[model samples]
Target: PRLREELKKNYWIVDNGYNSFPTQIPGEGGEMLCDDEIGDNIIGVLFAAQDTTATVMTWVVKYLHDEPKLLECVKV
Candidate 1:
């Protein structure tokens, strides 16, 4: 409810004859996305991003610990 209200307040639809764009909704080919689809996609992206960040951070820490010179270079 709050998300919908915020989106409605901040976003406006633009219709330029050939295409219609809903600024707050995620869509392609001029199709409007439903709230459930948008929510699912957002959740999926958040999980993927969180997983990737954790993996990258783990690798960075491992490399930094293995190579003191590389860590020093990064700090500088």
Candidate 2:
């Protein structure tokens, strides 16, 4: 319900005369997306973002450990 309201109130839709789609911002004359599709897309984006961040952080920590001088500088 809240998501639906948000979609309805989206700035692009309300201010720019853009049509709302279920999962994405469709181009002109595109069809609206369903709620489920939007939800799935949101979930996928969240997971992908989280995984990327985690992987980057893991590499950073590994590199920092390998370079004690850099790690000490960062600690300060």
Clashes per candidate, residues 3 or more apart or on different chains: 0, 1
Name the candidate that leads on TM-score.
1
Residue-wise lDDT of candidate 1 within 19-47, one digit each (tens)? Answer: 22233563554355785675465455457
Residue-wise lDDT of candidate 2 within 1-76, one digit each (tens)?
5554555567556365342333444433454566466546545655777754454455557768999997897799
| Model 2 residue 49 distance off true place after TM-score fit, in angstroms | 1.3
How accurate locally, in lDDT, is each candidate? 0.55, 0.56
Tell me how far the alpha carbon of residue 28 in candidate 2 is from the true structure, in angstroms, after superposition.
34
Error of 1 at 54 (Å): 0.2
Per-residue lDDT, model 2, residue 16, is 58
**RMSD of every prediction:** 15.3, 15.0
